[model samples]
Target: MLDINHIAKTFNPGTITEKKALVDADLHLQDGDFVTVIGGNGAGKSTMLNAVAGVFPVDRGNIVIDGEDVTDLSEHRRARLLGRVFQDPMTGTAAAMTIEENMALANRRGKHRSPFRWGITQKERSMFRDELARLGLGLENRMQAKVGLLSGGQRQALTLLMATLQKPQLLLLDEHTAALDPKTAAKVLHLTRELIQDHHLTAMMVTHNMKDALQYGNRIIMMHEGRVIVDVEPEMKASLRVENLLEMFEHTSGGKLDNDRMLLS
Candidate 1:
């Protein structure tokens, strides 16, 4: 469902602050594959996700989603093909909008909007209620409440629901649960797995938590210096421990894992 073909990206070219974010990074996902990404700081994990999402044009290579080459497509143009949940709960939803209002916007993603179709219809409200009810957080009862009033975990859960409202071809999760408390993060991660599996969606999740990475996905990939250094398939990943992953990184990258947040987590 997704193919990243030897993509590379550099920021502030020819300048003092120039940095190559992705170097020949390549990954392919089957229609229902859920892959977890792990890396230390500046390992090009988020860079690769942004590149695939077309946040900026890559200097070289192509990004294909569902067999369509979208390397040159603008970020908004790629929205129809991808659903994204960011690290910050505040980033995904409008604070001032009511729960249903925010969902209405998500439901219309990538479609042409008509000024005449301004209000939510009864059928649309019913659908939103059903979707919210699946969160099991009683958000269905708070459909009229402003999103700003929600707790961090609640808002994040709502954002996840909104992202998958239309089932985009690919889902990009960029450390989505990083900001939540451990208990909340665990709940969100569980919901994430259920949502992905239930919809049979293709997904790529960038996470700092090593155990979460290994425990959540069928495949795991590590990155270092803008390249994918290790990709553990299901057979290997099932037998692997966090310590094993650390050893693999040291052996492959010739450097010890230095990210404290990743290790301590």
Candidate 2:
């Protein structure tokens, strides 16, 4: 459902700050394929996701989603095909808006909004409540509460629900659980897996945790210096351990893993 062909992105080209975020990176994801991305700092993991999301135009190559070429499409245009959860919990939703209000905006994503019809209907409210209840966080009762008042984990969970409310062609999770405590992170991760599997959604999750990269997704890809060096399929990933992944990285990238956060995770 997603194809990235020979994509490359170089920031501030011809300048001293030139950084090659992606170098001829290529990847393909079938429908319902959930892939976890792991790499050290500046490994182009998030860059590839942003490129697919059209955050910025790539220097070269094409990106096709569901058979539609979106390489030249703007970020807002691509929003119709993508549901993204950022690394920061606060990035996805309006803090001042009520929970139901935030959900209403997500539900209307990519649709023409008429100012004449701006209020949430009772039916939509009921649907939002039901969806919030599925999170098991008691947010259904607090639909009228401000999103800013919720905890980090609660906000992230709500963001996840909103992102998948209409099931985009692809879901981009940029370390959506990185800021939460371990327990809360696990809860959000579990919710992530459940939602993706239940809806048969295609997803790419960028994570620093090796165990998480191995445990949550059907396939795993490791990047280094802007290139995808290792792509492990489901069959091989199922039998691999954390140490095995580290060894693979060293062998393929020709260097030891150096990210402290990744190592500790």
Candidate 3:
């Protein structure tokens, strides 16, 4: 579970270029609640995610995860509690490392480590192979292959597996599929849904793709001007269409969606 209480953040607060990234932003995620977030540029989608991830401190309010107050925690301290996949496929894994090596690192996350003790056991290698096989990307057979040799889609998929290997308390997906082609994006999305459902993981995803937002999550939230403008629950969200969401955005935000960056499909 996650709780964000009236958190506010501003960049360059007193300067002429000051930008308010968050304004009393409030959000709560029940255990296993997968919520999809949608908005155009500067809507604070990524900013809000970073706040929860402790990329930077909020100017106001508290962030609590699983009943612990983590607003004051550093990013490295919070890393153990979250599994994150960024928009860039290359951000999550060590490209030079072999697939098995990358997975071994993820498995050991949040644990004490020493340079003297860094060998992968046969059992751990077997586990890694099984997990990779499930992706249907044939990566299981390529465990010894360098991650840098993988395609964008393959790399992103591997990143997903690495992120969830430890079964994090919450999963944060910031347009994880954004950089892939349509077919690859859809495949990753499908894999995302499978992983979340199978693990009963709670997740928050920020996406520009309207269809992906509505199609995947149990709930959909729209942000405008650094505030959550629309939150559609499961029942209502299931029947909502792109046009309907656009109307709701205009109604609640008092402005039309003039940005071309947000995909309506």
The best-first sequence of candidates by lDDT reads 2, 1, 3
Question: lDDT of candidate 3 vs native?
Answer: 0.91
Question: Please, what are the lDDT tens digits per residue for candidate 3 over residues 55-106?
Answer: 9999999999999999999999999999999999989999999999899899
Cα lDDT tens digits, model 2, 141-232, are 99999999999999999999999999899999999999999999999999999999888899999999999998999999999988889999
TM-score of 3: 0.97
Residue 5 CA error for candidate 3 (Å)?
A: 0.6
The residue-by-residue lDDT of candidate 1 on 1-265, one tens digit each, is: 8889999999998999999899889888888989999988999999999999989999998988988999999998999988999999998999999999999999987688851277988898999999999888999999999999999999999999999999989999999999999999998999999999988899999999999998998999999989998988878888999999999999999999777789889
The lDDT per prediction is 0.92, 0.93, 0.91
Q: Which runs in model 3 stand beyond 4 Å of their true positions? A: none
Root-mean-square deviation per candidate: 1.1, 1.0, 1.2
Clashing pairs in 3: none
With a 3 Å backbone cut-off (N, CA, C), the pairs that clash in candidate 2 are: none
Judge candidate 1 at residue 93 and give its lDDT.
Answer: 96
Could you estimate the TM-score for every candidate? 0.98, 0.98, 0.97
